[model samples]
Target: MKSNRGRRRDMQIAADNGDRLSKLPNDLLLNILERVGTLDAVRTCILSRQMLKLPTMLSQIVIDLSLRDLVRMNGVVADVTDKILSARSPQITIHKLKVKFLLSPSRCLSIGKSVARAMATQKLDAAEFEILTPRDFQNCTEAYLLLFAAQLNNFLHACPDAFAGLTRLHLQNMRFAELDITNILITCKRLESLCFVECDAGICSVLNVEHARLVEFTIAFGEFKTVELSYLPKLQRMTYNYWPCDDNPLVLGFVPQLSELNLTNAGLSDKTLELSQLLANVHTVRDLYLNFHSEKIWVRPECSWVLAPVLAQLRTVNLDNLPEECDFAWTMFFLEAAQCLEELCFTVWDHKCCRESQKSFSKKTDVKWEPSSIHFKHKNLCKLTIYGFQSDKNFTSYIRRTMKTAVNIQEISLHDRKVCKICAEKFPQMEARPSSYPRTDEEKDSLRKKIAAKPTMVASPAMIHFPS
Candidate 1:
């Protein structure tokens, strides 16, 4: 009904109102684009001519393909990386960049060269690379590992600048030579975090790590006789899992600032490792985690005289995957020590799949430990959590003992057992024990009255939770 000029003005107003995102400030537009991934951001700006330059101005760049996408997208990833690096302006500083690609020498050579050129020309704050092997750990043969490691070496050799400025690296499924890993450590001088999954030297080879500025290290499924932390002064957290060793798994020498340690292993052997020998050197550890894989008791409890000094600064202790059939009273050996311990958590789970598939012949042995005679009342322990909680004599007795020991305990949490789908499907014949957790408010109050009426219960007014 209006004239042509008036209709054109209305259409312009509608379009201007619709395209509000582009009119935002440059700083805010960059922030929004960065929150979305770099790949998605570039795709989003395809039709918008005013915002086509935002991708080049982005500070954080991440080009990661999922597990199902690596094979098909490896070449695509290389092409995109090269395009991004070549198109990006050197004036804008890239704060963080990560590119993950399959270990193909040709593709890696292209990507590595682009990143190296960027490092030389632009202001890249930190660069990271996650190199994936062709095959998985189970399917990888020794020859495959050697070939993949050599390909990675070639990539490193081609673009030394990329690795030199890298802050994090995760290598998988490789059996490096004795000096190969040491050389990597020497070359990656600015590395803050490093991880190796299913990687090691030859059989029975000791992995002696010596790094000055490394902060976090993790090794999973490695066949090392002993991984000696020869010198990692600034190390904060270390995790070691499934180290197939009969002797002590780790030997710490000069990890002064180490505060957290995680160890996970499934051992059915009768050999029990002593913590006194394992942790005699590092005393600054504040968080400790040990997982037994619901099999045998692998760690032997030490006397207070031997363990107290080592656990002096320990604040949190998590003991995971204890078999549900075993008694929980033996874990008090740590509670009696650890004067500064604030939180103690325990998980009693029976992983049927892992037990039957991994070590079908190994039996779950009973843990034997007695409380220390030295009278030391704990005042710092305020919380206790139990997973796979059963309303049985073992659980109640353990709770009473903890309540009495920790007089100022603040709260108690009881959680239902964590069920694994694979475990339930594989072991369909095995029936899970029914939990006796109270259902109604009246029943819960009745249990609370009973717990409070018991004479062994402490006078501390602690709250109890039964989470369904």
Candidate 2:
């Protein structure tokens, strides 16, 4: 057996290390608790008498439980969350309170008041609540939605004036009406940022956002007839997943401070879409992104559509889905207009037009890349990136024009579109479809040599990159 003296020495060493942890200042100990995450920190309260009260003093609390845990625990998780929230000391100011939990009608009824009580007591800088939908969203009943909305409304109503100081609020995957949205915004008087994703607005035709302190906003996958931005003077960045092409268009009012705008699935038509009218007052935009779609070609001069306002402040532009069948001049209009543009990117995809037989690469093109204004040359242009490059005539013509006009160009990158691997093996048996894979390095080199030879080339030492 080990000697009694050796056992005493070993115990003394372990005691010294335990004392080091226990003797740490409460502030330093709290920092350690915060870094380990809320759940683990809360469990630390059981370590010793000193740790029992440490969780109550945390500056932030995050209650994150996935759907699997909720289903397996069968409502015990809600009880635990309630206990944790109830145990927090009111004097402790939480900087962030993030809760991501699966929601059901029954769970909402059980834990709604507990969550509201916690929110009302805490002074938070940022708050995010994500209510995950049921796995069978399509089969969800209307009664379930009614209960969920009722619980959420009650929680918002319980929010005290302390919630008004919240700087950011992100709500996702919930069905809320216009009244709920308005009430939440009005309650959070100092909210600077707001984001909503895949939220259903019940029977609401218009989402009128009239906030003074709000700066950034984003929305995706929602049904609303009109989104009216009226009195937002401090708004800076705005992103919409898809351009609003409903019966009524977005109303622009007093966004003089707006700088960046991004929209996916945009249209080039002036008849069905009112994008031109929407951009009338947005003259201060510096960065713009538009990903276009639709099979119909845009008639160039016949349509009489021009991007409103000479974007003197515009610096960066990203254009996607500019296919060969579409009017290439539509893109040229921006390059000619935005004289101060420093960076430009074009992304091509196979979703729009598909063919079986791959066409031979070409460097020569008949179309001219003439600027709308005779004196315009991209003096500030430095970088150009193109994805899904096939060395087609349209792209070759566009690049040739860019090389000639963008005198200060420094870098050019090319990426080929990716094809599904399994589908390629069956290409011979099937009808001709656009190959999803990029060109081989040898093929890319050949195309590069052909095009590099022809651009009565500008003298800048520009490097070309062809990434597989």
Candidate 3:
């Protein structure tokens, strides 16, 4: 239907576009493919002849079942993994490799042997295996936990080469014996990161770890009574979830390079944890995160002199999950001890789904404490971040006090309550206090003025922000 001139112009425009994408640099195009994931990237190769070679040139491969069509995905892990790995050219060295699959002996053996073959042929920078239990965690029984651990032990024995090359490993819903966990750590000599979800040695057994090359470790919802970081020289970051211990959940050992630590627990029967004793061995920590899980606060507030020795090097602190109505002034104890702290963040929310009553969770109350180091002033604190911030005195007075203490404070970011989609959907009829986050410039200015009008002390001038 078009004329000769029109036909020529259309073809010329298409040519100028260089087949729409074929002219892009190899690295840029590979990055786009990598971000979209390996399986999706392979399908994209059909778009153009130029992209067909991209799959063979990939340096990273990740096959996460959660990212795929998860319906009935339990049994096809072996076939999918073999197809992807077999298609790749062995000459291209993989920089990162991750495969998450369910616990099926035959399928798992096939996956491990395939990875072992790949490791023998090419240089794999890092490899990981995320093994999922046969059923959901809530449906797991004691006998099932023991059976899964034994099967994994046999799997490790069958493919020693693949286990040796792995740099990261994640296991879930397997309860190993005291010696089983120690043996796995020894076999995986090059491991740098390890994660365990609802897996433990026992309910009240002591677990000792001795890894030379391990750098980052995480354990969530484990029943171990006391975990000893016996000897880990290169360890830097550690995340520990709920524990049933009465004292400190971790026993710090020879970890000189440990810099960041995150601890989260729905308080275990109101047991108070003292940082001085728990962090006595590791003093180089620069960042600390503690989540109280919207229940009773478990940390015992200490005086500046008592906690200063260990908290002296701390630069940032995050105190999360405080009940919205409780007094936030109790958090000032960190600024009192960590004289070098540069940033402090807090999140105050009463999770509706976690609540037993409609009003609030403050019935259990927060850790009762008062300021002990009034004369001390923090010169390095530059940022204050608060979620679920309101214009009431509970928050305003706390801000005014912190401003007076943190003489060099530069910014205050106030945000609304973090939305929990699961809670909203599960408890649709539950009531929550209306959010008071400022929606306009006038409201933000008014709240800033109210907190800044301090007469008792010369508060440092700082910019206040209401994050939208």
Against the unseen true structure, what C-alpha lDDT does each candidate score? 0.84, 0.64, 0.83
User: Of the candidates shown, which would achieve the greatest lDDT relative to the real structure?
Assistant: 1
User: Candidate 1: where is the Cα deviation over 4 Å?
Assistant: 1-18, 356-362, 374-376, 459-462
Q: Write the per-residue lDDT of candidate 1 for residues 1-468, one digit (tens) a residue.
A: 999999999999988885887888889988888887678888877757888888878899998877568888899889878888889989989899999888888999998899989989999988889889879988998898888878877778788888888888999988887898998898888898999998899778899999998999999987899999999999999999988888867999899999999998887667787777888898999999999888877888878788888889899999999987788877887877688899999998888887735444237567888877735568889999999887677887788778778878889887878889988898888887787766787776766566666776674433777776
What TM-score would you give candidate 2 relative to the actual structure? 0.72
RMSD of each: 3.5, 6.7, 3.5
Top candidate when judged by TM-score against the true structure: 1
Which rank order by lDDT, best down to worst? Answer: 1, 3, 2
Off-target runs (Cα >4 Å) in candidate 3 are: 1-29, 46-53, 67-71, 74-76, 84-90, 355-362, 424-430, 460-462
lDDT by residue for model 3 over 1-468, one digit each (tens)? 999999999999987785666668888888888987677887777678888878767788887877244336645667766766777787788999988888888888999988988888877899999988776678899888888989999999999899899999999888897689988998899999999998998788788989999999999987888989999999999999888788657998999999999998877475788898999887899999998777767788888788898998999999888877667777888998898999999999877676544544446565567777567688999999998887777888888888888888989888888888878887777677887777888888878877887776465334888876
Question: Candidate 3 has what TM-score?
Answer: 0.90
Query: How do the candidates rank by TM-score, highest first?
Result: 1, 3, 2
